[model samples]
Target: MLELNFIRANKSRVIQGLKIKNFSEEDLQIVEEILSLDDTRKEVQTELDSLLAERNQLSKTIGDLMKAGKRAEAESQRERVGQLKEQAAKLEDSLKDTKVQLEELLLKVPNIPHESVPPGATPEDNEVYKAWASPLPELSSDALPHWELAQKYNIFDLELGVKLTGSGFPVYRGKGAKLERALISFFLDEATRAGFEEVIPPLMVNEDTARATGQLPDKEGQMYYVERDNLYLIPTAEVPVTNIYRDVILDAADFPVKMTAYTPCFRREAGSYGAHVRGLNRVHQFDKVEIVVLQHPDKSYETLQEMLAHVSGLLDKLELPYRILRLCGGDMSFTSALTFDFEVFSAAQKRWLEVSSVSNFETYQSNRMKLRFRDGKATRLAHTLNGSALALARVVAALLENNQTPEGIVIPKVLRDYTGFELLN
Candidate 1:
């Protein structure tokens, strides 16, 4: 959610940014509509203030008239006061309605992309910020994709998952289950070593929690909702972990508040059907280790670079051939001001799998969450940032496909200690 004052001041810039994000001309008109509604709100507020002041003065006068033995004048003043009260009540209702309308419209407006964001409308338009310079892994002609490999090795069973719950939910067995646990542990250890405090948050959140993180009304359809409880299954650990600071105020000393968590994310990948969605390429439930930061506005972008480095380090340790892409405006998330996606090459599948996305939301989420830090005498919204240290499904898929030999799949050396004997045969 954008600060109304910012939008009022930068109307043209906001419109241009929205246009880059592929907003239609019809949607661009929302900016003008918002301004008009704001004008009405100000007028209504001014009238309400004046009316209350007048009523207060008249009430005092009525007391004075009664004390001076002027009963008729006091009675007349009382009648006028009653009429003013009725008008005030009507104005209050109107003011409340206008505010509701204003908020609804504001929610519809997405965060404006940063000035550096490229103007484009699709994934193909995204710039390859960092290309893989090293040679990609090569597999033999008979190399099997992760799905076939899983069946041969008894790693995970998608068919059994359908019988248990539904598609996109795979049941890991034996070594596959152990490998998943190892990856989670490895990511968590890496995050903590880099000064991030680890947290275990609930997988489900209430409406306020969802809205505070910009998930409501925008990506609502992608979330799994529990109507009976009015709660939502979180799509990422970022939701619950970031909400920890919602409605909070902090000190300047806490410039970069960092935290991390591992969560089983739930997403409704509706209408997704293709050869690309095979195996662990896409799933309804998947494990991810997320890192979140709350930083001073001036240092937020700096913090973003640090986050990117951290994710890159993780991929490097895993020995995966990967590249980074600076997402184009239209390919970015609703709340992200800027984003960089990391893709690892799956040798057998012969495709790039997106395994992580690091983003700096600036004050987009902080404004909605009312998360702030005290700066001298005033409070300012904190910048919010989060990224998948690594989403395990694709990473696992890439690992199995790239490391497969006639004997077994070789686990990365860094995970050997965690996985014990990690030759998943």
Candidate 2:
């Protein structure tokens, strides 16, 4: 949510940002509507304040009149006070209603894009922030895609997953299961070494938690809801992990609060179909290691770079060929002020698959979460950032497809210790 004062002061800029974000002309009118509602709120508040002050003065006069033995005069003042009370009550209700309307409109407005964000409307318009300069690994004609490789090695079974759950769910078997565990351990260890505190948050969160992280009204359709309990299955560890600081206020000294978690994310990819969604390309449930940061506003962009470097280092260790893309305004998430996505080359599949997305929300989330830090005499919203150190499904797909050999699928050296005997055969 945007600070109301900011919107009031920078209405034109807010509208411009929304336009760049692909908001239609109809949606753009919301800004004007919000301002109008705010006007009503202020008018109601001023009237209520004046009315209360007048009533207080009249009640004091009534007491003085009664003490003076002027019973009739005091009774007249009492009647006037009763009328003022009724008027004040009505004004108070009007003020409350206006505030509710203001808040509802504010919630509909998305975070403004940073000035540096490119103006575009789709993924194709995103800039290639970093290109993969090295030669992409080439696979032989006989080389198999990850799904075929999985079958050859008895790695994971989509059919078994269908029997147990549904399509889009894959059950790992043998070395595939081991690989998943090894990747989780490897990512967690890497994060801890980089000074991030590891946390194991609950997989389900209440509606307040969901809304605090900007996942409720925006991406609610993608989440799995436990209707009876009113809980949502987390779509990403970012949702729960970042909410840890919800409603928290910290000292300025806590400039960078870093935390990480590994979780199984659940997303309902409704209406998704075709060859692009094959095997692990898209799934309802997937394991991922997420890194979240709450930073002082001035240092947030700097922290974002550090996070990008950390994720890049992981990919380097895994020896995956990858490139980073700076997402255009429309391609970015509703909560992200700026985002960079990492795509790894899948040799057998002959494509680039997104494996991670690092973003700096720049108070977009902190505002909604009420996460703040004290700066001198004033409190300010902190900037929140999060990234997939690596989402395992696509990483595994890239690993299996890119590492295929006449012998077997070779595990990256960084994960060998975790997997014990790594070469999946």
TM-score for every candidate vs. truth? 0.96, 0.95
lDDT (10s digit) by residue, model 1, range 308-362: 9999999999999999999999999998999999999999989999999999998
Question: Cα miss at 389, model 1 (Å)?
Answer: 0.5
- The TM-score obtained by model 2 is 0.95
Q: Tens digit of lDDT per residue, candidate 2, span 260-371?
A: 9999999998998789889899999999999999998899999999999999999999999999999999999888889999999999899999999999988888888999
Please list the Cα RMSD from the true structure of every candidate, rounded to 1 decimal place.
1.8, 2.1
lDDT of 1 at 125: 95
lDDT of each: 0.95, 0.93
